[model samples]
Target: MALASAMAAIAIDTLLPAFEQMRPAFGLSADSTQLSLTLTLFFAGMAVGTLFYGPLADAIGRKPLLFTSLGIYAGAAVVGALAPSLEVLLASRFVWGFAAAGPRTLTQAIVRDRFSGTAMARAMTLIQTVFFLGPILAPILGKGLVALGSWRYTLLFGAVSAGVLALWSLRLPETLAEENRRPLSFATTLAGFRSVIANRTTLGYTLAVTFGFGALFSFLASSELIFVDVYGRPSWFVPYFSTMSAIAAGVSIANNQMLRRVEARPLALSAGVAFTATSGALLAVTAASGGLPRIGVWILLFSLANASMIGFAPVAISLALEPMGALAGTAAAVVGFCSTGLGALLAAITDRAIAGDVMPIGVSYFVYGVLALACQLWARRASKPAHI
Candidate 1:
């Protein structure tokens, strides 16, 4: 499950270090923000693709859907590697993103089938912590491949990786039983969507997760530009980005530990407060310093802020899905759609808002953090108290 989820992270973060190299090769003008679309489009594809897979998985089975989706991803990766034009590359990437959503979202339904309450939250964080290694390692790997030959080699590597995972998924057993399987139909899928949307608390939590993902997507879309272009330290991009991912993974583990004794609500609230303060401070400092902060200052503040925000995901996801076990596939789809789709939109907006400075992106993180906290609070108010 962790490996499957990591596919998206690897696809995006791995290519980040190669953006500058890819720009000229693909005929993009210098300093063009168009490259960021590669990452954002992938998420947009995931957002759209996830809506269909969940109900289909619930109706048919998990294994077959996994096989089909991963196969699409693998084929897309090959097409991406050989893409002759930027249009072809972006289109293939979107298809890859759409395909990758199968394993990524369906795994959540698998987890929900096997666990509940705090156990489910713990499982999620643990899987996420493992999953985060992809980000920590992908940039370095991409950098290495770029060093070896060309950015196309990095794309080829993604192809091989997805192909391997696709075959590996063949051995996994289906978690959804015959008795629990819903008939695959438009009406059944629509009913599941309505069930999730009608629940105010679940909807609020899902939106909160969406905003949190939006903030992270904005950062990912801009990180390479900020470090390489704005800061003039192309060499440090991999290390700095890797360190932030490492911090997120460590925080996930820490969150899992805290969940052993602390309730997710309080821990999540504390994280929200920390994220807002740290990110807001970073924004203010950047503004005062006349655009970008010192590299050390930016890394430290962004890492801390991201760590706080990352810890909230497991808690929020688990809480939102707890009451929707029967609707797990559709619920997970809704969550994936809102978070990835809306998040991608936010990232694209923030990317366009960049004006040769980090101010817009920095301010976005602060604003996103604040809105995320508000959504969490609303979710809390709407739901009844539970042990989680």
Candidate 2:
């Protein structure tokens, strides 16, 4: 499950070091912001794909839909590798992301199938800890590939990984049982969507997760630019990126330990507060330094802020899906769509404003952090039993 969920992260991070190569290949200028479209469009595809996969998984079963998605994912990556034009490459990336969503969403549903409450949260945190390895290693791999040849090699690597995963997944058993399969119909899907929307705890925590994703996505869409273009530290990109991911991964392990003693809700709430504080510190430092903080200071605060958001993800996700019950797949889809789709949109907005300064990233993080905290608070309140 962790490996399947890591596929999207691998796809995204493996290309970060190759942006310079990609821009020239696509006939783009050195400073063109058009490359941001690659990430944003891929996310747009995931949003669309989420809606299709979730309900279908609930109906047909997880294994079949997962296999179908892996096939498409491999094919799309090959297309992306051989794409002759920028338009073609972007389109291929969209399809690749669409296919990637199936595995990513199903992992959550599959885990929910086998566990519940605190156990589910612990399982998710462990999955996420392993998942972070993709981010930790992908940039280095991308740099090595770029050194060997072309940026297209990164895409080819993605294709190969998908093929390997497809082979490995053949041995896995299906988690969804025959008794739990929903009918494949519009009404059934729509009813699931309605249930997700109508539940206060679900909707509130989902939105909170969305805001957290928005902040994280903004950082991701702009990280390479911030390192290479803004700070003129191309050499620092991989190390710093890996370090940030490593910290988040380590925090996930600590959070898993904390879950043994601490309830998921309070830990999640504390994380919200930490996220807000760290982001506010980032904003203050960035603003004080004229949007160009000392690189050490910037990275330190940014890592902490990123860690806080990521560390709480498993708990937040488990909370959102706790009330979902049999609609796990559909509810996971809604959460995935809102977080990836809306989050990507929010990131694009921040990315567009990042010409040579980190102000936009700072502002976006602080604002999103506060909004996420507000949503988390609302969710906590809504989860309380009503007085008779």
Q: Which candidate's TM-score is highest?
A: 2
- The TM-score of predicted model 1 comes to 0.97
Q: Please, what is the TM-score per model?
A: 0.97, 0.98
* Candidate 2 local lDDT, 153-223, one digit each (tens): 99999889888888999999999999999998889899989999899898888999898998898878789
Model 1 per-residue lDDT tens digits across residues 1-388: 8898888888887798888889999888767889898888899899989998989988987888888888888889889989999999999999989998998889899999998777788899999999889999999999999999999888888778878887787788889999999887888789899999988778888888888888888888988887777888877878888888888899999988988987766777888888889989989888998877787887788788788879888888888888888988889999999999998998788888887678887788888888988988988887764663
User: What lDDT does the true structure give each of the candidates?
Assistant: 0.86, 0.90
Where model 1 places Cα greater than 4 Å from the true spot, the runs are 385-388
Q: What is the clash tally of candidate 2?
A: 0
Model 2 scores a C-alpha lDDT of 0.90
